[model samples]
Target: MKFCLALLSLFFAVVVADHGDHSDYVVKTGEDLARYRDQCVAKLSIPADLVEKYKKWEYPDDEKSRCYLKCVLESFGLFDDAKGFDVHKVHHQLGGGDVDHSNELHGKIENCAKEGDAAGEDACTRAYRGALCFFKENLALVKQNVASK
Candidate 1:
């Protein structure tokens, strides 16, 4: 009976750990992180005043990038707790490296959900909008490889 209890506890721990990892994320290459992020950007424009501020963050860093992004995703009511963060803020903030912004958007949304506020919402939305404009103005056309279903 003790052995069975131990196994059960281990199983629960593993499950919780898995969920925790999924709660935060990173976007690799050739993934939808870029695509969805673009779609969001296409919809919203990052605030002009915040553009330089965003330009200061490190590219692809998970936490700060996620905070700015959460504002956009959750505002649209598309915040995903798992497997759904797509952040464009990282792109503009990080000097527009060859990174994927779409995947990061979901995380931004998650952060916003955690800390609910009109200020956060406004900031995120402006970030998203500004990031989008920055990207569209600066980069080549996004290859619509697989159209969204």
Candidate 2:
């Protein structure tokens, strides 16, 4: 899935704060992200075929994939049902804690959240939608960041 591929490209060197015990997940390198991905895959019981497809950047629009994105986002302290998305957390992580860059990233993230807003949908669906929008909006920057890493 384009969305999944782009979303995965967003991670770099950042440690998520403790959101009730989610402190253990610190995504400083690709290895840490892979560890969390494995955990989410096992926790959700995602199929081997699906995992393989995802690795190839082919995401299926299904519950498992959507929930997988949600799990990843939550692990990064980027999203939740109650808070929707922690824009500040994401800005800090992706913006490298740069206050001067805050407004630009913050506005982009806010717009994406609005684009993906679905009050009637489930949390996983909402998270997936928002992530899709977020990545699509920031694809170039994400690619640059990924290349740097």
Candidate 3:
């Protein structure tokens, strides 16, 4: 119950904090998203390659859905610790515990992947995908969590 309440509060906070409410910026279709890609590059001066990242920032194409979800979330934002208020940590803190519990046995594999020591970073990366999946599968839950608080 407490966990649920905490989650509710979190969702509302995110909603409130994101005042830009860039609802108008949504990429509803392949072509629509393509335009946004152009806008993002022209407006923000972000590189074309960087914009391409948005497309790749998605759930896995041929792997575990959960794994893909983690990958997507990881790419949502450009996390630079040098910049203040690292939102990346918030996402990580929120979703990692569940992944940790569900896939604990394979924990070392993930940990190694994170540090570039894992046999294959290509195969084991999950933080981003996990977050993306979490948001997609639980958008309502997140909104509720933020609102409650």
Candidate 4:
């Protein structure tokens, strides 16, 4: 009985740890974006004015801003330096796990992924390209998705 209990505890621990590592977060609000932005700004020591301008949608196209977006994407678990953005993850988060919306976003994500791939070798640059494409192509949807409730 003790051995069986120990095995159960081990299984539970593994499940919990795995869940913690791959947190299932849905970035569906301005608050969600703000949290990631604040964390990234602090981590990268990004200038306050730059963040303000970005909040206003005046994307800086600078190194710090580029990497800042990359950091934000990473926080959302939608991107990584080596793998770029994860389309399925982005679609699920932005589409609210709706299958219909997922189908619609897949094509756009793929197109943006292609653009990102063409954006040279800088991981930051690639992230920025993909992010920019997504926003530009789906401005209304993107805005609605990130609008604070």
Task: Give me the candidate number with maximum lDDT.
Answer: 4
How many clashes in each structure?
Answer: 23, 2, 25, 0
Off by over 4 Å in 3: 1-27, 58-149
Question: Candidate 4's C-alpha lDDT?
Answer: 0.79
lDDT of 2 by residue, 23-127 (tens): 332323445456767989999999999999766545678999999988977876778887687666665555544434347778898777765568888889988
Q: Which lDDT values do the candidates have, in the order given?
A: 0.41, 0.69, 0.39, 0.79
Cα lDDT of candidate 1 equals 0.41
Q: Model 3 misses residue 60 by how many Å?
A: 16
Minimal lDDT window, size 10, model 1: 140-149
* Residues 14-125 of candidate 1: C-alpha lDDT, one tens digit per residue: 9887555433333223244445444534454544444344444222423344444654444433343342333332332232234443555434533533333334344444
TM-score of 4: 0.75
Model 4: per-residue Cα lDDT over 55-109, one tens digit each: 8766778999889988988887888888777776777666765435336578888
What lDDT does candidate 2 reach at residue 139?
59
The weakest ten consecutive residues by lDDT in model 2 span 12-21
Question: Could you arrange the candidates by lDDT from highest to lowest?
Answer: 4, 2, 1, 3
